[model samples]
Target: MATVRGEDIVNTARTALGVDYVWGGNSLTSGVDCSGLVQQVYARYGISLPRTTYNQINIGASVSPNKLRPGDLVFFDTDRKKSGPDHVGIYMGGGKFIHAPRPGASVKISSLAEGYYMDRWLGGRRVSGVSADPSSGGGYAEEVAPRLDAHELAETYGMSYAFFKSQPELWKLLNGAVSAQWTPERFQAAVKNTSWWKNNSDSVRQSQVLAKTDPATHKATMEAARVAARQLAVKMGAILSEKNVDQLAKNMVHLNWQEAQVQNYLGAYVKFSSDHVLGGMAGAAAKAIKAEAYRNGVAVTEQSVLNNAQYLVRGLTTMEQVQASIRQQSAGLYPAFAEQIKAGASIQELASPYIQVVAQELGVPDTDVDVYSPKVKAAMTRANAQGQPEAMNLGDFTQMVRNDPAWRKQPGVADKTLNVGRQVLADMGLGF
Candidate 1:
């Protein structure tokens, strides 16, 4: 087994300083909720982690809080039910740990001595060598395998060429399976076995319907289906194009229902496109059907498209669900990403807003901007201290920010803007 140094782990955790917290999100960008932060940090150092705090606690040998060191995970049961661990943070040594606190909090360091955290503390686990290597078959090695491949399969089944091309693993898997000597039933069964495919099972059934239907009757059925689908599409598109978040939130329920219908249509369309055995159907009909199907498919499942819309709607709904105290406290807390997007700020300025916004929204002031900034600096500093050849520098930070979602959607933000921001930050001594 190999060891990841304490300083290296701290540095890795620091890089995630301002990432937003999404309940089940673990990615560095879109935002990582609590358990996600810990999972992502350790993963960067080749350490495998469970997706939830409770499961994560069992990852490595248990260590008493007194014996905790940097990179160790600190577990807590905030709910007080004692049912299971509900919150987690990374031990950054010297009685401090880094964590994504809650809805209104960003990733920040907090003292282990704090009464709140100390009372809920469920002890710590050292994950340094938990999963050294999957090929070598270590304790946690299997957990390290990428799960995004499932998403790839979903995107492929959805007939998203752009997503499939971006995710080669999924493309290869599907392409390989398609090329293999399997009947349509076998292929459909294999796809259904995946989590992604299971979520979109409606699409599968719709596809099967299209595949098995008679061509002559299909034309009439198809016309009726198109009319129904287009009406839903028009409604969803109208809601999505609105600028007001409140109206958007209100429209989401309707949109979600419409999305499901579009997904069904997409599935039917993809199956039709790939297995167009009906030689008698005119090319024009084929083309129209295919176009409608692809449009509906993307409308229902593109990562950035549907997910983003869902997120915005959900966030607003959640905000409205909470009490006035939580909402007011949340408003004061400084939205990590939203603040950066106010009025006219460049997207570069908004990078890392996810973590920042979560911290602020959660009303966890102890883990607010003032506390977060130094943690990031310290993480960067420690990375440099470790003498690791690949320690992230200004260039890395700039690249990270530019690639971050905060910058990805801004009005005038482009690759060129990112390069300029990198240059500017470097000149300002913040780069590297």
Candidate 2:
């Protein structure tokens, strides 16, 4: 999962606190309903959400209240007399959620543990970032695994092998399922109306962790995301007038786009326009890439977002792209990755100082985890031909290198190797 900052989402929503409530309104500054307020805040991040409370709750994966994080959508039966979920808010952690609390009230943050909401709490949802999935009119590509490949990992991550094998399209549902907390029955019922959800790669697989994006383009776009979003919305057939587009463009990008009059005749102006420009589905893939960068918790730039869009356009997912980028940089480790894999080592095992040095030496953007699996497989084949057994993991290889007294004296080798060793030692969290 990508590391989305709930703090960021909460802070954006925080900007709208005290705005007047308007029925069916979707604006924060002028006025907005409960769902509108939540929808608008998330839209700024390029996440598309349903306008209505009922639809919003039904779409994403569910989370137990105990696991609630910032940015989660919290549902409620505001009237206590109403049937089903009638109101919603964005959870801001610390037992609080922000919303436009009906007429005569302003947008404000309230507690989930409050008496009125606690009694009527319907549930919470975690939106799955499947923005470019085929079900949502996607244009990106992905590979299909054989029906037989719906094995234990598939089940472990989510879904039962027996069910997906019996129903090929069920794998497609898995993409939406595990990411959020949507139940199988609910997902099935909802997808029944959409033919796209049934069309999935034979077995669902994450393609790649994409390369770091081109920062220049990313900066250019994010700085102008609002204008670009409006223009693209017009291109995609949303009913934004040139005047509306210009007015929208004039404001800061973070303005309430969830406002109905501001964005569309029906609801907030085209919510997913930021992603649509990249590719129908490429946007979510782009978010996934940034999410990984956030998880890596290292240097992040506009390039990370750009790289996400670039690779997703070609059907590579975030992790797959990251691997590809590493391979491009790991030319030195083609031999090392091969040796490690030949010894039947796991990819996790290959994330070592050895891979780190090759990355530095090649001047490629890489973390310890970018060792390519394909080169490892090919190298394994060669090693087996030479009668080598699966004998050395990356750790063992590093130890062997450490033990060799002459390895320290080898010209052009010692500096690079020692630097990596020091760096690895400094990364206290990762176990060799």
Candidate 3:
């Protein structure tokens, strides 16, 4: 879709980002119909749209799908069982459109580039005073069109249009994410809630923003995440063949993951597999894990994938360490090794910080311990890595790592805390 330089219609449409879909309803908070949603939002800026899908589709000059811009109204022949512009939504560029889907559903955002909408797409119409095509006489749309589409969209969400627009980079991000059909609320929540956005340096925040929003960047990172999660799943799955891959798929459904989110979470679940781990573990564990990680300041950036990879390596090494040390180290070494661990590190630090320090001191190969690829490791230190992995200074998983081995073995602080309760856990030997 084309980018226009003036007031963005997407701006106003956002005010209703997550409203419920109430047939015939027109309130943004209470809900609205597809056309009601369109008309009400546009009306806020005084742009009139006939309060029905048929009339709304006729409000502006026709725009070809390929040439559609942000404020254009896209019509769909939804209910293919039916015909002709039965559905209407605002195109938000990058192949996404925003609208209130049908009953029992909320006024959520969705994509026009794919899914049912792609097949149903009828056409688009540019309202909100976007310039008419140069071929259409190089004039603007009627003065009656919404005067402040972009500004209104930002205002509805409690942000300044000037501040939002001034950051071309952020707009680029919003364009990519919204175009990808990410809800504005999710995008906003990510910004306000994620540590990478809240506490990072300005440059790091921009990089994190780009990594999360840019389709190409997010795609690549997600691909790696999928691979990592899958590898973890498979490796752990192999240990419990009875549990099977189908279990993973079921876990996804039961968790209510979107069609797009299943694979990524499947990857994460695989990364976290254990005999005691259930498919159910994924749903509860993910939020808790992410929340804990966030609280501890783990920056889930492009580097975070590496950090996960590092975690995979660390877990592998810990197993290797246990096996090797079991055979060679004297009984006393177990207690001695446990003594060196410092308590209260965050989970991020656990991957390498807690382990590697001791592993290196204990003569673990740099090969076995420093898992980050040299290039990724280097990029991490740079304030600007062009969206590549940066130093994951976001948060640390250190203390968690330090506490674990202590709980499992030797006379450490966590040992006295009654892990004594796990004998049945030991007895079952159940797994992922």
Best candidate (score: TM-score): 3
Instruction: Score every model by TM-score.
Output: 0.30, 0.30, 0.31
lDDT accuracy of residue 206 in candidate 1: 45
**Candidate of highest lDDT:** 2
What CA RMSD would candidate 3 show? 26.9
Taking the tens digit of each residue's C-alpha lDDT, what string does model 1 give over 1-432? 576666677778888888777777878766888889877877787777778877887887888865666667888889975688999888776667888888866778776655467567787887745322234444332122122233333332334334434435445656665455343335446756756546544644443334333444545554554455544433333222223333322233223335543433322222112343211112222333333323211112233223323322223322222222232332233233223333433222332343353333333343444313543333232324455322234445445545546555656557757788899999989976
Q: Model 2: per-residue lDDT, tens digit, 150-248?
A: 242233333344444444455566555545545434454554444533543222221110011233553454447556756555443344566766555
Error of 1 at 66 (Å): 1.3
Please give the CA lDDT of all the candidate structures.
Answer: 0.51, 0.55, 0.52
The CA lDDT at 197 in model 1 is 49
Q: Write the per-residue lDDT of candidate 3 for residues 1-432, one digit (tens) a residue.
A: 343432356777787888889989989888898999888877776576798997877776887766766677889897767666898987776556789999888877776534356556688887645543233665553322222244333333344455455556545555555455454445565446544346555544443434433547645644554454455455433222324444543343233335345434334333333443323333333344444444233334434333333333334333333222322322122222222222333322333453454343334454454323232233233333564322344233233333445334534545534454465566689433
Order of all candidates by lDDT, from best down to worst? 2, 3, 1
The alpha-carbon RMSD values of the candidates against the true structure, listed in the order shown, are 36.7, 30.0, 26.9
What is the C-alpha local distance difference test score of candidate 3?
0.52
